[model samples]
Target: MARVYSIVSGKGGTGKTSSAINLAAALNSLGEDVIVVDANISTPNVGIHLGAPIVPVTLNHVLTNRAEVTEAIYKHESGLKILPSSLSTQDLGRIKHENLVQVVKQLKRLSKYIILDSAAGLGKETEASILASDEVIIVTQPEMPAVTDALKAVKLCEQLGKPVKGFILTRHRWKKSEMQVENILDMLEIPAVGLIPEDKNMQKALMLKSPIVNSYPKSKASKAYFETARRLLGIKEEKGFFERIFGS
Candidate 1:
């Protein structure tokens, strides 16, 4: 079975989907068969980040027994396959627990890495996504609320006996920024894996519906994501100038 890694966050708009897309792209660049599963069925947008439109089939169709999971995946020329969500009529929708488990089992046999782009907040679906994964990347910003909420998610992961591989500090600006990162990690007792700087290129990439790694490979944000991917696969240790500034 393939190792699944879920990219999750506690609050909305903390760059969880961005991290998920870029990390999956980076893994593909390394010649790994990466499948990005847009598990955020309610508000799916990974396809937009990848510059791909919503495919005909999605997780919703598969979960509803309308299509096979394998048939719903869209293969990219970049070597990344994306399983986007059905953006049609998700009003008051919920993924059944049994179907979620079966979906994970089905994905395990199809790819080298199943990167689940989970939704914001601590919902039932978020909990199930984390529980199904062997490792998780909790993306957060430098703000207090983001850290506090992430701790709550960490506690949930602990309750489910899931291992949090590390935390990724997103939207960080200066090298000396995010002074609270170390405190957050110390309080949660989780390792710090990445610190992605705030870059305008990221926004431009999003607006253009292209991944930073693919659109601007030499950009700082892209390089940071590549390093994060390296750390995720144990190919390299965490190294960043901000670590010295934040003492993390």
Candidate 2:
């Protein structure tokens, strides 16, 4: 059975969607079959991030009994399959959040990893995604407000009995103003799985409508994402000799 990880955040602009896309890409690069689903039905962006802003079928169709989950699956040039939600506003009301668990169950048979890019904040859609996931990875910024909100998300996951796969910190600048890794982990009561640094190349990758890992593998962000993927798969990452000599 595939492991379903719902990439969630307590608030928007925390790079939850970006983390989901890049992590899926990184896993695929490691020879794993991965499918990313846009479970954020109301404000979906997985399709947009993958360069397929529109598709004939989507999660919305699957939930409403209009289409099979397989029909919404689209393969990106990078080899990662995505089940994106419809971009039309009209489809929002038609989605039955209760069907999400069944949809996820169907997807588990298709890939090694099923990444659900859940909506930010505590809402009906987010709740549905959380309940369906086998585990969750909370994405947050290295700041107070974001971390606070992430704590709320962590508590909710606890209440639902979902295993939190730990926190993935994004847009990290490594500046003094940002929250320290140790403190963030302690406060959230979750271990640090990955720390993605702020890289200018991310903007270029976004403009080109491709994952940073695929577009700029040499960039810091891509390297961090790859490391994150390795950690998730229980693969040990070896540091370069130069880094070992200079201290990472």
Pairs that clash in candidate 1 = none
Q: lDDT by residue for model 2 over 1-248, one digit each (tens)?
A: 68999998898989998999999999999999999999999899988888999889888889999998899999999999999998999978777897999999999999989999999787889989999999999999998999999999999999999999988999989799889777887899887777899999988998999999999999999999998898899886677521342233
| Cα-based RMSD of candidate 1 | 2.3
- Looking at model 2, the pairs that clash are none
- Write candidate 1's Cα lDDT for 17-108 as tens digits: 99999999998998888889888877787887876766787888888888898888998767788998877766326556347668888888
Which ten-residue region of model 2 has the weakest summed lDDT? 239-248
Against the true structure, what is each candidate's TM-score?
Answer: 0.91, 0.95
